[model samples]
Target: MISILFLIAVAASIITAIMGLSFLISCIWEKETRAALYAGLQFLLMLGLVFLLFYLEATAFFETATGRAGLILGLVLTGGTFALLTLRIGSNPQALQGTRGLMVGNVKRYDERDIVFARNRTLSPGLEQYQAYYELHPEHEQYDAARRKRGGPLGKPGSIDKPQDRPNVAATLASLSIPLHLSTPEKFNPSQHPEFSQQRVELSPASASARIKGYTLSIGAKLVGITEINPLWIYANRGEIFNENWDDWGREIELTHKYAVVFATEMGFELVGTAPHSSTTIASMANYASGAFIATQLAAFIANLGYSATANHLRHYDAALVPLAVDAGLGETGRLGYLMTKDFGPRVRLGAVTTDLALIPDNPVDIGVEDFCKICKKCAHCCPSNSIPLDDQEAVNGTRRWKLNAETCFDYWGKVGTDCNICMRVCPWSHANTSPHKLIRTLITRNRYSRYLFNSMDDIFYGRKPKPKPAPEWARFDE
Candidate 1:
């Protein structure tokens, strides 16, 4: 019995030490210095404990009556505890179910003017568009005025706006704006060239979809999905400034596209891990530019094929991206109110090309994200603005889900001079998709018990409120 017990202890220690070493190595390879340091310390502590256990066993401590009794009691207690945990958190038999009904059934269409981005862009104090908007929706006047007083994102002297970082951030924004210049009817309308419009190429739905997906991937899209355009996803009116000379400033936007090709561009983890910093803003703008470049090229490609296509990217979006992305099977809408992909979680920027091309639509997937999100409140706990909800899903806009406080979130962005990404930084799913993390993710996707276990383990390993990592060395500049 003593020999058996000694072997069991040795085996358990070896397994734990191996896991610790693996995690330490992974952290080092990922350049997570803080995490690596912690992992190293943990590994050393585990080794020390294992050595102490071996010493106790080798010294014949368990041969004495009291020592033998104590050893038996310890083994029994440990085994019983593990058994209880296993029974209490056993894997569920059912696969991931559709939670779409929670947010889609009886949903009310959202207005573009009500969106924070639209409001911020249109609410300059002495502008005609501003006055018109205020006259139409008087309730928003006070809040809009207050935000204006605080100054706006990036351009203002705020918490994260270092003088040295401003140029890089501005350059990224400038690059993003260039694509918006091309997002006009003059650019989208193939009819402007009668010869090009006259030559039509016919292809099957499957072939066209494959071509579009392949082209998008070739042009740097991390993920792509096609879906039939749902009218409900389109905005009721044009609230953004699309064209300066266009007569229809706030007129209704009529998107007659039959298909929508949505795609995502990954935001670098190193930059995004910096959270509410200048580096994060730079990454955000860079990804937005990538999305814009991909969407515009794809739209032009379809137009050249004699099919009408319009790129919906940064500074020009006719539809809500999250819903379209969800419908297109790119990802599910996470509790953080961002599209969570299997590879990158919410660490992605979305772009779409709405076109008249016939294509096969991808079905929405059930990858246990909904269930995992239900148990994981790490994002909410780590939010600097405390804008994320801590409770269960609630009904908002006739749909049941975790509704974010967009007002507070945007306000925090203005104060910080960057989009505060604490939620994104700390999401367990946002971890690098290396072997260890991937294995855990697979287990998480397989069962509800795994979700709880992983969530708890993640909290223990990487704190519930993990601090933002420092910006990369290359990102630093002389102030």
Candidate 2:
């Protein structure tokens, strides 16, 4: 029996050593230098401990009652700790079920004009739309004026002192010309195109849903979901695209669609590592463009299917993509005001298509994002502009959510010459999708204790305010 107990200890030590070594390798691959160092030191310490255990056995220390009892206690405690981290032992404290707690009151329709981008970019002074918007809401004038002086995010003489290099400029121009400055809504949506005004084929709701979801995945969408359209999620009117000289600018957007299919595309983990840099903006643009292309193609496919569908991309949104994504069962909103996906965390770009086609809708999921965010305020702590809220969630727009200060956040963008994505970069959920991280992510959405455990570990492994990584070689800039 004593020999058997010794053998068990040996096997347990081997398993733990493998885990430690694998994590050390994964951290190196993830470019987490600090974490890699930590992993390395931890692996060595475990190796030393294992050796010490064997040395004691060699010295016949286990013959003593005190040594045997100590070994047993150590094994028991170690087993309990691992089980606590890995097992699902209890119910969530407050995770909503099937979207039941999505809304606590009347969800008010949001005005797209109030979005920071619209207030600063599209509603430029000297435009009629700009004058009308300011006249209606004089309160925004002071904030808008401050942002205007700072110039655009890619301003050559902007806050980031580093040179904006040629490749960076080209990428920014491509993003603007392709999505924002060049294409209009009519060009983006197939249903709006005169040639595809009519549907050609028809299929049952069940078949249509499956086909659409499959196609979405095939065409670069990492995640896809379907849900009944919630009118409250739709914007009350257009604002951002008003001055692009379309008649529908600022017009009431009444999308009477019964269903909405949402798509989420994963942003490159390495690319996002270089947050607050021009490379980060490049990542954002690339994903947004990919989402636009995928959504547009899908709308055309639906038009061919004899259904009325309207694509909602970054450049042509009639509704809030995050809310639509949540309703579509893709993920839940986090405190940082981004979708926290089960697989990709907050590192995803969302696109949607609202349609009148009869399709089965997916139920909203509870991934413990609400409960996890409550304890893990990493995003709030790391936001460069202090835009994210550190306090508890409050009722906003008829729901409980952490509201980000968009104006200050965008202002920091102008100062940095890029979208300061420190929040996304520092979020523990946004960690690289390695095996160890996957294990942690599973526990995060399961037991609440895992949230607290991993939260502290994240801070220790990656620092409370982690530094941004250098950009990809091609887009690299001198510090």
Candidate 3:
């Protein structure tokens, strides 16, 4: 019995020490200096404890009947505690309750003009468009006025502005602007070439979906999915900039596409980890440009194949990309109000192409994100603007989900001179998709118990509020 107790103690110590060392290495590889330092300290402490335990055992401390009984009792108590925690927090008879009936039926279609991005874009105070919008929704006039008075456009001087990062931010914005021209009606019109009309290619839905997915992957898309266009996903009206030839600028948008191809591009982890700083905006714009480029190429490819297709990207989007992405089996809508994919979480920018071409639609997946998000509110707790909700999902736009305070979120952006990404930066799911994190994600997707265990472990190791990482060397122009 004494020998058995000694073996158990030694084995436990060895396992804990190995885990600590592994975590320390991961933090170092990911450039998480603070976390690495903490991990290193933890590994040392674990080693010290193991040495102490072995010394106590070598001294024959457990040879006495009382000591042996105490050792066995301690092991049983520890094991029982862990078992109780697993059963209480990890066991869920209804795994899909959080996401199953959410937005399932009778979802209220959202208006594009109601989005904060559209509201900010149309803030040309005193202009006819501006006045018309304010007159239609008088409640937003005061909020819009405040946002304009702040005068902190992207890359400009404001609360979180870094002069050294302005050039990179400006370059990112410029690159994204070029794709705006390609999103207009003029580009949507099919080619009038003599042979173009007769060059129609026919392929099965499965074959076409596979080809499109492969091509998108080749062109730098991180993820891709196909889905039939749901009318509810389309905007009720146009709110962003539009060409003069399209007379119905603010009118209800009529997108006659049969299918939608949604894809996402990765935002660099290092850049995004900078949160409200210029590096975050630089990453955001960079991914937007990449998504636009991919969507435009795919649209052009379809057009050349004698089919009508319109690219929906950063500058011009007719549909809510998140819902389209969810329906296309890309990911689940997370608590942070972003599409959380199995691979990248919310660290991706979405783009889409709407076309008349037929394609097999991918079914929406239930990977336990909605369930995990219910318990893991790290993003909400870390949000600088406090725009994310802390309570349960409520009914909004006919769907039961966490609704973000868009006004406050954008207000913070106006003050910061960049889109505040503190929530994204601190998200547990937003960790680098390496082997260790991938293993955690695999467990998280499987059952409720793993989600609770990983969430607790994540908070302990990475902290409930992680500090922002420094920008990459190239982006640090101050040096």
Order the candidate numbers by TM-score, best to worst: 2, 3, 1
The CA lDDT at 104 in model 2 is 86
- lDDT string, candidate 3, 300-380, tens digits: 877777778888888788899988898888888889999999888899999999988888988777677878999899989
Tens digit of per-residue lDDT, candidate 2, span 167-260: 7757866875555532465555555345655635667889999999999999999999998987888999887663356466688988888999
**Which lDDT tens digits does candidate 1 get at residues 1-479?**
88798777667767767778888888887777767887888788878868977888878887888767877787788677555534424332221222344554676556777788888876577778888888999998999888978977764777565677666576657766866766676554434246565688888998999999999999999899988887778888777775674355677879889889999998888878888777777788888888878888888888877888888888688888887888787767778888888888888999999998899988876656778888998898888788989888788766667889999999998898787787888998888877777766766765567778889878876787887777777775335
Candidate 1 backbone clash number: 0
The lDDT, on a scale of 0 to 1, for candidate 3 is: 0.79
**For every model in order, what is the number of clashing pairs?**
0, 0, 1
Top of the candidates by TM-score = 2
> How much lDDT does each candidate structure score?
0.78, 0.81, 0.79
Better of 1 and 2 by TM-score: 2
Clashes in model 1: which pairs? Answer: none
Give me the displacement of residue 25 in model 3, in angstroms: 2.0
Task: Report the Cα lDDT for candidate 1.
Answer: 0.78
For candidate 3, which ten residues in a row score worst on lDDT?
A: 91-100
Decoy 3 TM-score against native: 0.85
Off by over 4 Å in 1: 1-20, 41-100, 103-105, 188-197, 477-479
